[model samples]
Target: MPGAHGGSQLPLFSLTIMESVLDAIHARYAPVDARVAEILENIRRDCRALERESRNQGNERQVEEFIDRLRAEFGERVVIERQRLSAWAVRTTRWNYLFTVRGDSTDRIVLVAHYDTWRGPGADDNTTGEEIVKQYLLADLRAARRPALTHTYFLAGSEECGLVGLSSQLLLALGLQAANLALTQQNWLWAVVAAALAPLAGYRFGVSGSREYVKTLSTEQLRRIRGVVSVDSVGEGRLYIPRGTLGADFLHALIPFGDYDSINDLLEEAAHLHGIKYNNYLAGGTTDHVSFLEVNNGLWVRGREAARRVAARLARRPYTPPLRVPATALVAMLPGKASPLVFGGKIHTPRDTPDRVYPGPLRETLLILDYFFHRLDGGARVGEPRNLDEFHYARLYRTAAGHLLALKDAVEPNRRNVNGVYRATATVEGKRGIATVRDLVGWGVETRLRDQVAEICAQLGLTWERERIDELEVIGDDARLHFARHLTPFQRLAKASHRAIAAVQSVVRNWIFLTFFALAWVLAQVFGWALDVAFSLSTPFALWVAEHTVLTLIAVVAVEIAILLYMMARRIPTWIDNAYRHENRADNLGSLRRVRDQTLR
Candidate 1:
């Protein structure tokens, strides 16, 4: 097994696949998840409904109707928060909406998309994403029997005029966590006139359209979070991102891309009907994912990875911490395209409507939705899901590779030589199809090669970083680690007893703290209040006493070091005999055992 519990090897409750189930909820996919289509129609209907309300024909009637309809459909899941903006067409202009579906989890992941537009339906700019998310949410909600998470949101608004409501929503979300305080208080602090600019400065940068978005997402947090996946400005066309080659042998993708099995997975499918290429775009900025990198430094460490280990330790019926280290390992950007089928066969425009949005991306979106469900059902651990020795453990080791790659890229921007690896300038080969030191070791395997690897490591002075002759399997868990298996039964018993004794000794640790506290109190009283009372005036006397004491202590340490070095230099026989008084080490313990054995003989 790669990355699973050893018990049955196959995880309990098998992975959950809720894609079709969700599609059914929205009535989108035909014959099964027809709800998908239904969900799309609803998006268009909602947009038109909002437009009608804005037209002043219905006035407040339309606004109230819209909210009531949403509450009726979504039930208690949707919550509303009101705000007043200084600049508005009318007083107390309600400018925003945040829809949500909670799950049964402690941590929250925010996935935001806007739905508002200045005019013409504003479909492709966001209508596409809005529909996709709505369908996804409807599908997720249909299966209410499954667990639900809280505090996550689906935010939609018209970004054409300005970010407006979205900014406040984000600030509230991040502020609560960043300042280790309530979201309301943190916002008040951030919005206050006297608060320094530095604490929440990350909002000013990101891939978003805002100039001062820090009130929303902080740059420091973005840098510190585990990972981010973005989807933006996609329609009929294939998804594309430009990632230069890491090495000649490495693939075009610098890291894992989406939930697809392979590039060919995207190249073929119902999407094939539309003829899209989900290829790398190389260098272009359309959506807001760049903001994640632009602000919030970069959450390089893994969050999912840590959570997985923790959840595994809990193992449900009653939760418990795992015996392993945990951290986040993967972050991604998921930018979706607009509907291939919409009004007038266009997207991201008022003309972009439910009639023309394609089914392909929707299907893909459903599949991703299924991935989230499956991850939750089986416990969302980092890396490929499998048994103990299989994928999971391998990822634990590969997680280190992320940090290494980051370091390598930073140090070798020109793809020059890495720390110990041969660079473009240093690599040499006299013939084509020839192997150099760069080739994979096991394939060109030999004892001599391993010896050479060790030799090269020693030469480079990075044996630890490069490789060691010792098999890593020795450190592998699910078996023995650190200690050898060859010890006799008696030795094992004795060693176990020794460890038990040490564990028992640990119970009295508080005694050390109590002793230190008692001594400190005694010194404070003797040299503090009593002396002050005796002197009747303390300032000059206390200062003078400390100076002499501090200087004398430093002088005593200097004298001791000097005397020790002098004895060593002269090779003098000092009276001191340095020996470790241990029962298990090579000296007294061995002697005692030998003596006992001889006496028995």
Candidate 2:
């Protein structure tokens, strides 16, 4: 079970022997699903046919021929479209081909690959990926019945030139989705992006292209997405699943690498004359699936909050708003291998000739994808799939209470430290890790701890920046530790709710204070005028305090501080009471029966 869901409790290993054992198991195994074997055979035939047509010809002509052949083979399942790109007034167009198989479910799994090469015949770089994706598409089309999940093939052009074609295609999709206002509906089950899956010798797993694509998606689009699987460079007779988040970087971390057991199961079952060899490791690089991991996790939630705030203001309702809850979790499945060092080195060079390509890797790659498709159709979630405990609750009572205690200890009764300073330097360690708050007071300690956690997230490559902790911010999502089994999504949601409520209260309270000050000033002016007429008094100072800008600013500051102090004095007891109550509830919620009993009571 260590590798069942695509992770292991044992440390990552790169030993050749381990790779050999796994490969041997795969080669001897027989597929449990008859359809998987049938589809693999179809993939083999298509790959062979495609290989025979390879030549160091024009890129456009090659792409066109490939598209034509696919359309002819798959019939109505195939659709081809062209998109234009412009830079500095220079324009260029690339073709995008799609093959769709509709199913009973609205959830769709999209497979992507590029058809163009950087130079030469680009056999290993993408030809293999293209054919593999096409084969899967054709197999699904030829099936006697529809699978439970929809499968879409997206064959993009100009990928070798800098992913231009894929970029255009994604933007076009988003534009269409926005125009149709389909953000609320579930659309993507996951996306599998393939490139360089036929490399010889040692293979590297890369998902940089996928990451780029994910980075472009809006938060709403991201929410519907479950995961991204990258099928790249499978030719080395070995299967590898890099740490999902790091993609290629997992190789560089000197950590052991392993494959998803489900994928491995299919590979083992489908192996023919060739054996699959692979070792998961740590290294960093980019691939198309990286886009899946880079999706904006909380943008939609924030937009909804903004909308609620506007509605609340119009309705004159209390500003307390619901917390953000993302529709999907961050899960990326990176299948093993890109071109081995030897094969990849020739990719962009003229040496990338037809002779460098082979059929063995292509065949193995197809089998792996075939099994993956079957599993998806059977309803298995990949890459950090959540369970009931994760969805319903979190063990954050200790963490939260500890944080509160730290805040309480950071301040003296007078709100200053022994050094007569309101701020202190402190640190706290938790289930996640250690965090340091430098030069912080009671309230500042809370802020500093949050900031430090965010900083740690950046160092671990969990966030785009060091300050923003989006919905997917968690240790378990890390490509290395995806098997940790517990996540704190609910705890984060609760914190976000509390933060939002506090922010609204602050704004409304400030507005109220300013309104009262303005009213008092107006009344003072009227009284001053009445006194001026009733008694001959030199009240220039009183008038100047109202008229002079500096005097007015000083008066406002004094009033604001007084208001803030009064509010804090009034709220401190309430805050303490709530904190204790929540801590008690958290402790009680840890046990399922206790939670139910408490509810009943």
Candidate 3:
């Protein structure tokens, strides 16, 4: 999964799921003599505890307790590491631990899960994620067969605070956890990140703010990454991920873990292959992986909402050809296939707890992610997501469940074929957005209006003919589909005017300049002013008003003139010159008039 690296669609955990993980780990403990929360109560009872344990340090006791509890639950399989940071905040020190099933190979892949949650008891946000990772760790040790890729494992504390523990101590602790100098010395550390931030590499990435969870391709250093798969809420409550988009290409299979859990959910699997079942994780909050996506230099896949925006604008079709839909909508649909689910609900209230989650169809989500990540990491090479039959087909497709029996093999999120219409076609299809295939076809058809835009550009004496947009126009049958071509000249003019307005409005009506205008108005109101300076007579009140108003107006104009002079310093003509020329051209055109009378008929 995505972790602090770029060149990926998703950045892993750039925000706040840390607290949730911590909360889950916290709940797993009874603190020896002190009963979990009771211990916290005791600690809080003491002022020294508050002083010595202030948020970070106090969390350490909780961390230690969690390590002990995990040890009890998973036995010697859990490796806990504690670091005392005396140099930083007063009593604050970070404790990070790595949990690996004994006999786990360094040659195998790594499962990176941060055990830190933010603020309070974050159950859905990440307690579930933390629990899944910890359970996976234990299950990894107890399982009769270790996963193909298992390079030890890890957990972090204080992830809520910029992933400092994960970034620093965890790397060292993994070595100590494995008890092998070579394990941490020269091993490839690949990961399957749960939570919103998935691993990044291909088109499927992460998103911020929205549930889609994509990362900037430009955010991380990509030398160490192998592959990534994340789960997030595809906007509009749909779930998706970008797999085979050529602009952001990907392998075509999701791993199959028979049972679903957060740890395995990101890899994408339709059914139980290898005892792993896909389960949908009830998610809330962000993940630590976001900081790691598109690790080099890239942006997230365009969002569905953004695509919808372009689609809405296309529906308007106010002259400018709405031919860009195919590309624009496709770009926006880039991140969903890999994301988990999202809901529009108020947060932090008591109503949000495990009891609120109903167990329905989440198994595929867990199965898919785990399978995708492992396979991408090397459980399987980049190819079609196959079933037990090796039939190379997708079984767990998104249909109204049980409705599909035969044709479910084709929609592997990564198998797209745009052979004809446009060689480079983008598709923005999500759960809800993908409801209509006809809509997609229509979008592709409407995208052909580039011809009109090219024509308009040519008429304007612009150098746009050789451009790609100029070379292509989506051609379709006019009988049933007549798309509007070319933007109206008035719209073109309004756009031009708006552009000019944005660029020059600052100077034209700046508050500082407007202050001068206001002063002019004040003078006019108080003493009476005239717009025409030459026509003013010698009435005392009018003379005073005119003098002050003109003086203020002149000063404002002079400032603008100074700004123009500054801009002209670069040897380019000032925009003021253009503004003046436009006005002059309008005046010249206005001066010539031919009056013609026509009959009403």
Q: Which ten-residue region of model 3 has the weakest summed lDDT?
A: 324-333
- Count clashing residue pairs per candidate: 87, 49, 104
lDDT of each: 0.32, 0.38, 0.30
How are the candidates ranked when ordered by TM-score, highest leading?
A: 2, 1, 3
Candidate 1 per-residue lDDT, tens place, 150-178, comes to 43333322233334333533554464344
- Residue lDDT tens for model 3, 1-601: 2111101222112122243432232333222123222322322332233244344445456546667777777666545544332222111124445544433333333344443333333333333334444444555556566555443343444334234322332443343334333343543332212111222212221111111112212212132233323222211121222221111111111111111122222232222222221112211123323323322212223244456668878898533321110000000111111122213231222222343222211222333334443443344322222221211111111221111111111122222100011111212232111111111111110111233223333444433221111011121122111111234577557546654643562243212223333544465454323435433554675566566987866765576555543333211222322332343222222111112212222
Give stretches of model 1 more than 4 Å off.
1-35, 47-66, 73-78, 82-94, 146-151, 161-235, 240-277, 282-285, 288-295, 298-355, 376-601
Candidate 3 deviant stretches above 4 angstroms: 1-63, 69-78, 83-93, 101-108, 161-286, 294-351, 360-362, 373-601
Lowest summed lDDT across 10 adjacent residues in model 1 is found at: 403-412
RMSD of each: 24.9, 23.7, 23.4
**Which TM-score value belongs to model 3?**
0.32
Error of 2 at 532 (Å): 88
